[model samples]
Target: MRERPPAAELDAVDRRIVDALQGGFPVCERPYAAAAESLGIAEEELLARLQSLLDRKVLTRFGPMFQIERMGGAFVLAALAVPEADWARVNDAVNAFPEVAHNYRRESDLNTPFNMWFVLATETREGIAEAVRKIEAATGLVVHPFPKLKEYFVEMKLAVRGEALS
Candidate 1:
């Protein structure tokens, strides 16, 4: 896979676009047009720029952020100590499940046993456990689930200037 370009490569227009759309998006028939107008750019330009950003991997995803728990769903963080040689197989096996929202491989820490981590979302709390069991059965590896116990306040507004903001 190709590495994503650095944020420093983003232009002023790109920065403005990222900053303006980071917050709540407009709920209108022509949402893009409305947003583009607010950003002082043409609708077509806004769409094209967003597409380019996505294609370049500058923006990993652009969509609504849903509160699954509030909507009678459950989300959990799960991990596995996948052997280096079996990384691809395990990744594919676990990600094949629809409940697997996303997964990433992390360097194993001396203190932690698990190296691969992923988020699983399901329609119910029981579904979370079921997905974990399914993944364990499919990969022949135990899935350690870490469910959220307390809520934390997090502000996710990122003003992607010509520099890293994350």
Candidate 2:
């Protein structure tokens, strides 16, 4: 078998592009042009860099996070304690639901049993329980729901390590 090629490395310009658009993305008719102008690069270059960053897995997502509750929708956090032997099967069963928005695997401490966590998005608040029921029935594991008590707006922005970004 051929050895896989090494992953691409991020350069100074790529680092700037990653850090520059962390909190606020341009919202103008020519948003790319505006953003590119601010970064001292052409719109085409910026677009290319963004796509490359995505392709390299340096950036997982680049978009707005919607406040679903404002639109009469509900987003619930739920989890399950999946057995190691049945992880793949249980994962498939849970992800089969249309209401599932995001799913994650968590390392459980000595006392905790819940290992799989996910978010459920539904059109109505009552739909949360129904989704939980469906997931429980499908996975044969008890679903634990954690309702959000407070919301905080936190922007995740960081300069490249050992580099003076500002």
Candidate 3:
């Protein structure tokens, strides 16, 4: 059994900062500074706290979630089946491609159906297809590429609210 980490209490100020940064960071060049002003804290302090939270796993990820359609970037939704013996090695090889945003391990018949799944972002359909091909060749396994026909909605926000929003 895995041991759980100790719970850390968050003060009002910390909650405020976390809530402010939950949705997305400001798109401007000085995002931290903007977030600092909105949270009523010094820019440096905001950076420090954010770093601490990241180190502590309070924030799993903190960055931009690009609008691929608006940016003319192709989003390839894909999955792969790997033998249990090859799961870890194949997962690492597939994720080595920089275009891969993130991947997840899912339970499958081969021991896991989508033992590996990820999104590849590129400027063209052909590019994404090529990436899938390269990943398959590199991993010595079949990769099922499923390019998204449309994006109905992407719900990513998860804020622990109660603090004021600026």
Candidate 4:
């Protein structure tokens, strides 16, 4: 983890720069410069501010967020209960698959259970299944791969404007 910057260190310009880039600045060749101009700052200065924000853990990541399905990739939301003693091993195993985006450790009823979750993207269901199989083999645990049943509710929007959302 990177060291966080002091909150008091951030000035109005830094805050504004973070806010402007959060929701997404612009989708053009000169996105940074455009955003900088909007905030009345130089392009290099804005870039440096963004870098500071990142270094301080104010922003985990930056750049374009894609629509996976539109880009011909598949994603499924699933979780696993991993024993505490085995959590590290299981986490590594699940994440070993190329399709696995990320996994997190969460508290659960299952003793020492760390939630192993990921998205498997591929050209077809068979490919996703194959990826899951690889995870299963690596972890030596049966993954309960519960794919999206249907689009019952898919409401995703920016909760806060000018704030980047993962």
**1 against 3, candidate with superior TM-score:** 1
- Model 3, 1-166: lDDT tens digits are 1346755556677777777777756789998998899888999999898888788887776787676767667887788877888767887898889879878766645655666788888876577878988998899988888876766977766666453334
Instruction: Judging by lDDT, tell me the better candidate of 1 and 3.
Output: 1
Clashing pairs in 4: 22-164
lDDT of 1 by residue, 1-46 (tens): 2344445467778888888898678888999999999999999999
**TM-score against native, each model:** 0.87, 0.82, 0.74, 0.72
- Local accuracy by lDDT, each model: 0.85, 0.85, 0.77, 0.70
Q: Comparing candidate 1 with candidate 2, which one achieves the higher TM-score?
A: 1
Maximum-TM-score candidate:
1
Candidate 2 Cα misplacement greater than 4 A, ranges: 1-8, 152-155, 158-166
Please, what are the lDDT tens digits per residue for candidate 2 over residues 64-145?
Answer: 8777898888999998988889999998999899999999888745847888899999988889999999998998899999
* Candidate 4, poorest ten consecutive residues by summed lDDT: 157-166
- List the candidate numbers ranked by TM-score, top first: 1, 2, 3, 4
Query: In model 3, which runs have C-alpha deviations exceeding 4 angstroms?
Result: 1-11, 23-33, 60-63, 108-112, 161-166
